[model samples]
Structure formats: structure tokens, C-alpha cells
Target: MKVIIVGYGRMGKEVEAICAQRKHTIVAKVDPVCGDAPALTKELADQADVAIEFALPESAYDNVKLYTELDLPAVCGTTGWYDRVDEFRNLVTQSSIGYLYGSNFSIGAHLFFKLVARAAQLINPFPEYDIMGFEAHHNRKKDSPSGTALSIANIILENVERKKTILTDKCDHSINESELHFASLRGGHIPGIHKVIIDSEADTIEVSHSARNRGGLALGAVLASEWLKDKKGFFNIDDFISERLKYTQMI
Candidate 1:
């Protein structure tokens, strides 16, 4: 697979290493020092089979937009730009481009989210089980709650319908939510840590996904790019795992 790396910073360099190890070639890199969207050439755009975006939230929109406009596939690992997700979705749908994005690309994180969903469903019947989410990441991370935490919380909210909203508890009744709380911490060089804790008068349950590094995420992105070669449309990790998850249900 030939890839164009958007964002030549830390994650981009790490992704380059993974692509090299997987026998994939990075034909070019898009960085702010080089040029913005208008500087991207049609030839350079056409050269890549897919683009892996690890750019900042502010820049991610333009990077992904470029790919979609060129009818190229894209695998995005950017966070904090969800305020414009609807626009991105529209671009992908209209162009018939293959676009896949995730808050965190690590397989463990994906499984962690699935587990949270399942647990939420199981605990929905028990109103005594109140839930709260917390996540920590490196100080350099832009988003406070971490997109992974938000994703997990959203999944939990879907299964446990009693919770109308997810927010940090500051000892106030602001949002009028009954049973959900979300909190975040950012410090050190921590890769990532996300925990969902359920508390009740009887006991407590906790599920977590801790990312020690970025290698696994890079691997998943490469695999997704490979899977998307001939496909066109928006997708996510679940699309790749649907068959495996179904088989697991049988067992």
C-alpha cells in the first residue's frame, strides 16, 4: 500500500515506521511547514492509494476534505474536531470516497468500547448502578475528555437510556442528568488511560483500556487502509469486526 502521511509530527513518524515495517511505502508527507491544502498537487494526490491523517483538529478537516474531493480513500486518527463531523460525513457520502475514522485506532481500545457497550446493556436493568467515566492522556493532547472517552461514553449512553447526558460532576445539577458523569485529566507523557466505573450500594465495577504506545493503532490503520482499497464509503472498526464479533456470539 502506498500512503500519503498528513501531519509529519510524532504520530505521523510513528505511522511511517509501521508502514515501513509492513512493506508499505509513504510516497509523500503533508506538513504545515510545507504548504496548506492549496499547495497539494493533483499528481501528488493521485499518487497515493490512501492517506492516513494524524493532523491537528483544526487542520484535519482540510486534509480529509482534500482526499474526498480527489476521490481518494482516507483513514483518520484525529480527535477534537467532531464539531464538524457532519460536514465530513457529507463530503464522504457525496464523493463516494472511502473514509474511516476513529478516536483511537488501537484494537484494544475498540474492544474496550465494545465491552463498555455490553456492560451498559447488562447494567441498564439495575438503576442502582450509577456510571462515571474518566480518561487521562499526555499533556500535549489537545482535547480534554479525549475522544476515546467520549466514544465510550456515547456507547454506554446508547445502551443505558436512563442517562440523558454525560458531563463532569462539579457538585451541581446543571444538565439534569440522573446517572452519568464524565471527567478528564491530562498530564505527564501518558499515552492514554480510560476507565468506566459503575458504583452501587452493594459493589462497584470498573472497565478500562490503557494504551502504552501507538504501534497497535498504526497497525490497525494500515490494515484498514488495505481493507479499503476497493471499497468506497464511510466505515469504522466495527465494519471490519462485524464478522468476527458475530462468530464470537455463536461461541
Candidate 2:
């Protein structure tokens, strides 16, 4: 399969290596910095089987739109522009394109997401336990409260009834019980780390996920592209995840 990789940064490079290992041809890379083709031509688009995108937050909107223009299926890992997801959905729906995106593209992270959700559901009846979480990522990372953390926050919010909102700010004063303080810490070289805490006067329960490197994300992105190749529609990574998990359950 011929692939067009968007974003020529660390993650993009990682995906490139994985694509090579998996024997997928890279037809083009769509980044301004190091990519050979900063923009896709009809020739390149027609030759490309799929596009895997890991560009900047600012570039995500336009990059994904370009995929629609080319009728290319895309698997995007860039974050922080989801406020315009409605626009993306409309474009994919109208153009009959396939677009799948997610905050984290690690299978382990998805498993961790499920673990956190189950823990939150189990702890929901215990009102005495309070819940809060924090995430730490490499200092150079652009977005605070990394998209993975927000996804986890959403999972917790969906499962745990008491928490109505997420608090990403520094709590200068005592915070309300209904507020879940999901903090973000930027530091040296930490790839990613997220921990959800359920605490009370008696005991503390914590579920955490840590990334050693970008390998998991790279593999997952490639797998997502393979799943999306013949499909058309807007989808989250969880759709792919859920479909695979269902087959496992059947077995």
C-alpha cells in the first residue's frame, strides 16, 4: 500500500519507520519543514492509498480538509482543534471520505482508558471518595492538558456521576467537590504520563498509563489506516478499537 505521511516531525518519522517495516510505500510526506511534497498534487493523491497525519494543532484542520479534497482516507493524531469537529464531520459526510482521529493512538492507552473507566464506575457509588487526576508530558509539547488526558477525563466524567466539570487551572483556593482537578505538568523528556486518583480518608486508588516512547502510537496509526482504507465516514479511534474488542469478546 502506498502511504502519504503528514507532519515530518518525531511522530511522523516514527510512523515512517513503521510503514517501512510493514512494507508500505511512502508516496509523499506533507509537511513544510522536511517533507518532499509540502502539498499534495493530484498525481500524488491518486497514487496514495491512505494518509497518516500527525501534524501541528494549527495545521490539523487544513491538513484533514486536503485529504477530503483528494478523497483520501486519513488517520489523524493531531489534537487541540476538535472544536471544529462538526465542520470535519460535514466535510467527510458530504465528500464521502473517511477520517479517523484520536488523541492518543496507542493500543495500551486505549486499554488503560477502559481500566480507568471501569475503576471510575466501580467507585461511583462511594461518595466519600473524591477523584482527581494529573498528566505530565515533555516540556516541548504544544498543548497543555494533553489530548490523551482530556480523553481520559471524558471517560471518567462519563462513568463517574458526581464530577460534572474538569478543572485544569491551578486551584488557588479550595475547589468544589463536583470539580475534577485534572492538572497538567510539563517537564523534561517525559513522553506522557497520566494518573487518575480516587482518594478518601481511608485509602487511595490510582490507575495510571505511561508511554515509554512513540512506538505504540506509530503502530496504532498504521493499523488505523489499514482499517480505514475501504471505509467512508467520520470516526473516532474508539470505533476501530471497539470493533476489534468485540471480536475478542466473541471468542
Which candidate leads the pack in TM-score? 2
What does the lDDT read for residue 216 in candidate 2? Answer: 86
Clashing pairs in 1: none
Error of 1 at 69 (Å): 4.5
Tens-digit lDDT string for candidate 1 (128-221): 8888889888889886777677788789889997897777545465445454688888899999999999888999999988888988888877
lDDT (Cα) of model 2 = 0.89
- Worst lDDT run of 10 residues, candidate 1, spans 32-41
lDDT for 32 (candidate 1)? 65
| lDDT tens per residue, model 2, 1-251 | 89999888999999999999999999998788899997777788899889998988898878777888888888999877889999989888888778999877899899899899889999899899988999999889888888788888999899889999998989887988788899999989998999999899999999999999998899999999999988999999999999999979921
- Candidate 2, residue 208: Cα displacement in angstroms equals 0.7
- The estimated TM-scores of all candidates read 0.82, 0.89
Candidate 2 displacement at residue 167 in angstroms: 2.6
